[model samples]
Target: MTRENRRGALASLVRTLAVALVLLLPAPAVLADRAPIAPAPSAAGVLGATTYPLSLVDDDGRAVTIAKEPRRIVSAAPSTTEIVFAVGLGDRVVGVTDFCDYPEAAQSLPKIGGFKPNLEAIIGAQPDVVLAVRGFPAEIIANLEVMKIPVVILNPVDFTGVLANVERVGDIGNAHDAANTLVTSLRQRWDAVEAKAKGAAGRPRVLFEIDASYPGSIMAAGPGTFIDAMLKAVGADNAVAPVAGGMQYPSVSDEAVLGLAPEMVILGDAPYGQSVEALAARPGWDVVPAVRDGRVVTLSQREVDVTSRPGPRIVDGLEAVAQVVRPELFGPSDTSR
Candidate 1:
């Protein structure tokens, strides 16, 4: 009951209260650790626009119109067939050419034959639109036009053209959402490849044989060709550039090929029994850098057909080439057949 004792007791009580308050309070920056961190959503899907009546120009400089959604589409070329399916119109594809074989589903479609398609079969399919490439005989395109079936020519000369064709296919098929999504994905992949390619070693001179078998016969990819552009994009130079002569595909003799002395050789003859071992054993190819460096490579037949063509699957082809050219930078998607 003394004054000093009472003052001492009050000070002790204040200290105890301060200690309890400190225990109840959170640690510094505790909110930073406890606040629910929202995770990023996966890029799983895309939403399409609600409107329709999209019009565009085809590769042949013709003003094409998509009045209503295309219920049935006939792809007259392999590249054309690929772009059609890539834009999410697989179900709408009623007919395809004998050469159109990638999505496996295309192999099951009704065939219109190769080079010059069976017009009767195409008409029988009764497609709302017919997609063709620039090389599909002018007569075939004209015949389709005469039939009153909308024919859109898709001949992509390069990577950009390939993307444009993909979007155009979607526009014609009325699958804008799917097209946009696909384009975004493709661009992302290509950008990634380009970024990695910038840091790759100096460009290697490459010889791209269009056909694998060569008993004194040769067709190689030249300047302004898709393979040339793709090789350049991935930090490889096309050896055919020296003898290209303004031809996208030029027939070269064995002497011409020997003259180029390409640092690498990519055989487009997957359909044939061509292999690195076989290419290395060719007559007078012993001194070639491709044989010396063991850089002779071949892609699957499907990959060769797709990558060579300017279409949505072209990126996949790029993947295969990049793997062969600079496997250190871009890993192989598949090494075996």
Candidate 2:
């Protein structure tokens, strides 16, 4: 196989693993039924304190009780790590997965494996609580529980779910004040983008490219995914949604993309060396409206991380999409965080 083929195979394997993990999660309807914990403001306008022995139903539909504030945390996913740090609990994070690279501080933390966690390493961390997302093996969770370690699984399906997870983490770490403030700021940013989108001239059809390493098979973000939600929230239509065949992430042929006629193309894989120039050079791709019109937008590494990761910065992802889809309405996005 050629180098491109190897990359394609690797990408396919990664996607397969991601889908398999997501399948382990409870249905979206089930998670939606569980109401998010609302933080109450104190007389001084700060969020009220969290009560000890806090009990709540996590996204995985499991009853988890945190006896007291967690002093040491183990994050099993990048999103979970971001949530822990965002809620002002970074100092308490003892271990993070190999994939967790944001916030600079997490980079120096001990690694607890990725995709498949290192059970021994996790145990060595001696964490007060283990924070994880969907896709972690059920057996691992059971093993941790048997060892008297609390595992909180957080799997948010949409924007609202992300905010709720942040609050939930705060509650576990007794950082309700920081979580409330962060959620409020995120909501304000979301509303601001939505207001701008409402004033746009018209909604444009956009294609979010997940991987373009293999020209024979192009991966795209489809319905029921964070990318799709961000596009819709910013008042743009997903060009691949109609032909996705119920898959959250689908591989499409060049013909299919041509038929979709996307007005704008967002390169979610730009960090991996994909570029507007490279895309334009592809055979027959130049005729595509987005390419011919030079409407291909390449996202930076930080942009890709914020857009793809379901964490506190997802609102930043919404704004990034808005800037690309409706540049006249929204200005350049801030990806500094």
Candidate 3:
């Protein structure tokens, strides 16, 4: 397969496996619906300082020790890249995957390959530490470890976990102050959305379409996916949740979707040429509430990136979803930000 095709396949595989992995593992307290716990005032004196030879554990439960504050960092995933930059470690980033194209400056960085990363390119970056995520090849991680490269895997299952991962990245980079501030702002934004959502009349059933390439069987975010969590957080029920049968990303047929009668539809595949007009043009789709009422929300490529990624910008995704689900409360969708 070509590079693009390979990356696409890898992304699909990752999405399919992510929620399964979460299900097999014991849920962490940090994954609770509440915001990340704030550090006590007494801990403030040392919050900015990270002791050297730091021993830590990643989401994958691998033990890693940082010999010193890493001056050169490499990101293996777009989410990690965004977290590294958000934590004030962008300058230290020497390499990133081909998919890491956000924050503008990241686009100028040396590409370290994508999906299956180039080991040589990673080594060439001379990184003190590499920030990775789940679904990264285990053999590659083993090779990097044998080469004495510290690879920290960050896999957050929910919004709360996302905030915790931000702090974890900050700890790795010795930019705890910046990470804490970013998490605080994210939590505040999340709380505001939650508050607004609570005042809404009722939770509407929303269909979050992931892919419409196979129009006969539209792929959608199911019960355990981040999109489902986002809809829940924004006072909306997932139309697919009731029929997903525990599948994270389920494929639904036109008849099934029609039966569900979703109040709104979020086209995550809008960047791939799926549009409201095209959806409305479909035969027998006129009966769907979203199609009939013009309640379908189409996401731009940038908006899709922000919403799909479980990174620092996820709160931006939450706000966007809130706007779509409860426009009367959160106002119109603003993708420019």
Candidate 4:
């Protein structure tokens, strides 16, 4: 062959050798080196289909929208924290209110302060979403926006709002199915309790006290509050309705409670860790008809405080009342404790 032919032939031989080496490489090695990265799941999948249009009217009246499902969430209220955990998004929650005690798991999560919130602590969590109650101060909400953390404010003060809030949390957490089951079960349980309570021949008169020491300034449930609705649901008459103006910290008089004469008194587990006996022993409480008759019954703080938080807990609350007011209706067992 000529010199030029030899050079061309040499180049062709080199190319063939290179191709042979490539084919002889181990398949596993080739694959391991050239493997493609898997794409992350879309926001919709993370948030759930029901949450696609997730948005809320803030306290300032602006329609705040969360364009995507949040991976790191900060809940500003105890009730909202409970709602988040109930909806099965507890794993995504990175921050919670200091008082969130339900589900037991919440105790381990980072606390972002209470209803007022600690903006710096919230920001430190690097949350993509922040949950707040509608009545939260507008200025705090505005600050959250300034930090670029999306906020969804929920208002679950009444029965209807509580149901709505459950769905809302489910939507936010991409757990609509769980939310539906939760709300439906709650309704059924409450309905069953109501039916049983109503069937009783005698409906007991009840007085619910928030602070027993201050009988003249007692905080009681009246119409429109969850406790008020719960009282009626369990077929009990509220003694404070006439005295309470359907607002928090309703001013009730000693004479009013004495005059209404509640056959049963429902006390919430307040000043946490204090027992029913302690509340009953408080000064001036002995004068209340409920205390005098040994009718005082203590309930979980979760059931009464921050009423109608919108979840299965409300049913638990109503059930508690039924057991207290009409024990025979709920069978002989005490399920309220």
lDDT of 2 at 199: 77
Candidate 2 residue-wise lDDT, 22-78, digit = tens: 112111111001122222232123456788898999999999988877888999888
lDDT of 4 by residue, 13-98 (tens): 21111111112211111110112112112223333365454677643457877767677888876667767777677788899877
The list of candidate 1 runs beyond 4 A from truth reads: 1-55, 212-217, 270-273, 332-337
What overall lDDT goes with each candidate model? 0.67, 0.75, 0.76, 0.61
Per-candidate TM-scores read 0.78, 0.84, 0.86, 0.75
Q: Candidate 1's error at 197, in angstroms?
A: 1.1
lDDT per residue for candidate 1 within 148-232, as digits (tens), equals 6778888666788888887777667667777777788878877887788989989899988764344754567778866777798
The per-candidate count of clashes, in order, stands at: 1, 0, 0, 1
Error of 1 at 235 (Å): 0.9
**Global fold similarity of model 2 (TM-score):** 0.84
For all predictions, the C-alpha RMSD in Å is 26.6, 8.6, 8.3, 25.2
Per-residue CA lDDT of candidate 3, range 1-337, in tens?
7644643453463342221011111111111122322322222234588988989999999999899989999998888888888777788889998878766788899988976799999999999999988878898889889988899999888888899999998888788888888899989988988887898898799998876666566778888777888888988999988788887777788889999999988776654456777678776789999888767766655556656678877887787778777877776432222
Instruction: Give the lDDT of residue 56 in candidate 2.
Output: 90
Please rank every candidate by lDDT, starting with the best. 3, 2, 1, 4
Of 3 and 4, the candidate ahead on TM-score is 3
With candidate 4 superimposed using the best TM-score fit, by how many Å does residue 264's alpha carbon deviate from the native? 1.2
TM-score for candidate 3, please give it. Answer: 0.86
Score residue 22 of candidate 4 by CA lDDT: 16
